[model samples]
Target: MAFSEEFLSELRARADMESVASSYVTLKRRGRILTGLCPFHNEKTPSFTVYPETQSYYCFGCGNGGDVITFIKNIENLDYVEAVRLLAERVGLDVPQDSRYDAGLFERRRRMFEANRLAARYFFKALYSEAGQAGLAYYHERGLSDAIIRKFGLGFAPKGWENLRRYLNGEGFSDRELFEANLIRKSSRSDRESYYDAFSERVMFPILDLRGNVLAFSGRAITPDAQRKYVNTSDTLVYKKGENLFALNLARKSKAGSLILCEGNMDVVALHQAGFDNAVAGLGTALTEQQAALLSRYTSEVLLCYDNDEAGQKAIRRALSILEKTTLHVKVIRMQGGKDPDEIIKTHGPERFRALLQDAANDVEYRIMQARGAYDVSTSDGKTAFLTDACKVLADLQSPVELDVYASRLAEETGVEKAAILAQAGQLRKTVSRKRERDRLRDARAAAAPAQKAIDAVNPERAKRLRAARAEETLLASIMHNPDIFSQIKGEIEPDDFVTAFNARVFAAVGACMQQYGHFSLSMLEGDFTPAESSAVAAILAQIPNLADTLQECRDCIRVMREEKGKVGRGEACSLSDSDFLKLFKP
Candidate 1:
């Protein structure tokens, strides 16, 4: 769906690329670009560069680049319309609606949101009522305070098949609406009247979005004899799994500028009640890429506050793999004298938990500690193996100074020779660099294969086509980097003149977006391009030279393209055009 140009323009003007990017990435000013770690992928070096002058960003490491809107779309895992709406909300403006989606779509989402909110209030009230006594006792046994319980919108699902179903239905919600909102469900019995409350005899936790909308709920069993341990809201029109963090609604407001990621909702709740409101938890057993991106949008760092159990430690390793893909600085919080943050808080009080947060180990330190935990460092063979693995890890460090520091530390910790470890690390770096070069070359060759199979059976015709494609790509890159070049060439070339269909389509999108916004914006074209096309566009823009160099190359490319087109056309190859660009390129 298309948004109004005026609204999009205003949105762009308000959401500065640098400022929006800085919200997720720690950007350092570097000449015309703000260089930072790419939030789209893992990289020790800062390959993600934001060009504020053009209101765009490009990541050399991952080739995920676009304008501010596109950045927000991908970073937040939102659709184009949703991304625009979010930005508009940020600037206190309303987005103009499009009719492509049914008008009731918004109404359905609103009703679902309202239903969940009302259900939460109903459940919360019940927690204090006689029907909620069991749930209240459970919370008390777990030592949950009144304030903390209310803060999370925690409630109790009264025992019975239709307690919540009846409660919400009386509040003007139909049974079908209740089911759609995940508040009620049908039984396995084949009878048509088999409806029952989705959650029964459980302590309920309302999961809210960052905007404080009650999108869903999670119910923990209060009775041991309950058939299930935990029951959560199924996906609904308004809620999605692996998307919203349990406590991000409150944690996003924290001034810590960092987040504490835990494995369970109770851990997050406990940490928040202990005065660390910056805590959030992964929804499932492991952290997801979507969750990581969401956290990056709010804070620049994450403290992994998973439990100390084997599963929890394993989850931490998995989480690190995902978190590194974002710009957030990661640290591990190992709870001592307890199993998880909740237990730690209860056993040692809030001060010890605060101390743990302060003393969290950086990812690198955690990795080395993990390596040491794997074997007896005192043994000669174990030390050798540890040094070998440690050096391999150290080899991948982007900084030579970091390599030296870690290498020395490894030597001291393992009683190995510092020079020997350094030598091994150097060799490992060479191997890794060579492998990366091979992988890059492989990727280039793969990208070179035509997206749409244009006839390339013969070598000469294929070569001609490849050259033409290059010229088309170069010219498109020029316009993408410099909007002034767009009008200069718009009247001269057709999309058909481009050899590749994908590039032609992207070129068309660029022109359309530039015309609509009265400016060049990569994000404006993002809605139409596929992921591969977006990556291709990013690769083209990431390697752009200076404007003078780009203009010269663009001219050469245009000439080559025109020459190739002439070869396949009825016109004379020697015919000269009256266009000013042709005259300018006459020399």
Candidate 2:
């Protein structure tokens, strides 16, 4: 799926970076670049910058720098090929079908998509068949209507080993493709290879992406004797379980201002059927930071509608901790007379559940109530413990009026003086504020050296020869800033002369770009390196603004790398003795 440089260039030209970025980030002109708050990570101050000249962007706060394609890839959660296609469609340019494309990673993912799509169709067809009668009855017992079932593309996996295996095999899918899609499991018995359906006698729920492609499945067992009532698709080529929400594809389309976060697929469907279409659930996993960020993208708030049990309460706490870091407002939906949303809707009806949602508690209110439940506020020691927990929760409240309101309530409940409670909460708030500021300072220092910090995790030698690595980074950054410098430094520093493999690869790529286009931009490295590597390269070049004399700095940096290269056993510096390492880095 690789595009020609000319097509990419044309696409980049038609889809201006500034225009494209403005759709997501509220950017303001800053001399040669534009700045905005980063959408990748939550930040109060704007650190995300866009360089229209290079058709590139880099975030100082989160280090998510890349070309427009990379931006779309991360923002929309798509693969490289998909992102390119999206950008092409955006600019009204048809992606050229290049047969030279390797049928490796991208092709494998395509096959998985096809397999999942066909599997979903087969399951839905099976739901209406004789084998799926019990599953249909199970849905009926749960009160899911025919229209609601079809809207969610509900299906049934029949009881047997070869049901899906036989159907998909007839549909021209290889066993490997089905296995990779998590639709079937492979087995070897008596020296013969065999495959079987992964789900059996279960009501099938096809988890889809934003594009409405069936990515995976979560099945609830229909029979009583079946082990593990629910069996979800393992992470496959087409899906990462924790990275996706179950019904988000449909939920995203809901006009509802907030999303109701549920615990299971049934709860989501039930809530959606009851006119709460913005309900979504995790894919058979606990809430993830990634999922939380995904939720923040579509909604202004998230209503935690998990079950009314100990495990569900724990899940709510875990979810609040992650969601609190995002910009989204969060509330907890405390259910009554039922275990889960489905049970609540079934028992007291959806109207009662709707009323509960209307009166849902904010995260702070929820935390304070949880604290009250943890200890007896009437007793002295219990009152102290409750106050301590309540103050910790109150400390995070951003609004002064809200904090005082909660504090006054705590004082009234415990019969403690209102001023004393306020004083304790204020002290806790100051302590938390100091700790956050210290963390922010430490992170700022780490971010200052993002290039070295990023490489240190994978390239140990880069850290050992810090002087040489920094020099290499500067030389590369200079060349990226002014591609003409490559002509001057080409003879002085070749790829092999570099100490770091990643920098060497980038240098080689830069040399190739310079030779072909006579200029280099961050977009040239789009397909060659990973998203993280591209961001690191952007980070390296972000330091170039201070370089007054690019040609001389490039030469000076090249000289430093050459000096490091002249050392004996160049790459062995990382394994050297402490004194030897110090001497190797000596000026």
Clashing pairs in 1: none
Give the alpha carbon lDDT tens digit for every residue of 133-182 in model 1: 88888888888888999899899988788777777778888887888887
The top-ranked prediction according to TM-score is 2
**lDDT at position 534, candidate 2:** 74
Clashes of each: 0, 0
With a 3 Å backbone cut-off (N, CA, C), the pairs that clash in candidate 2 are none
Candidate 1 deviant stretches above 4 angstroms: 92-111, 165-188, 191-196, 234-243, 255-258, 293-301, 322-331, 354-464, 480-488, 506-543, 546-556, 562-587
TM-score of 2: 0.89
Error of 2 at 403 (Å): 2.1
lDDT at residue 575 of model 2 (Cα atoms)? 72
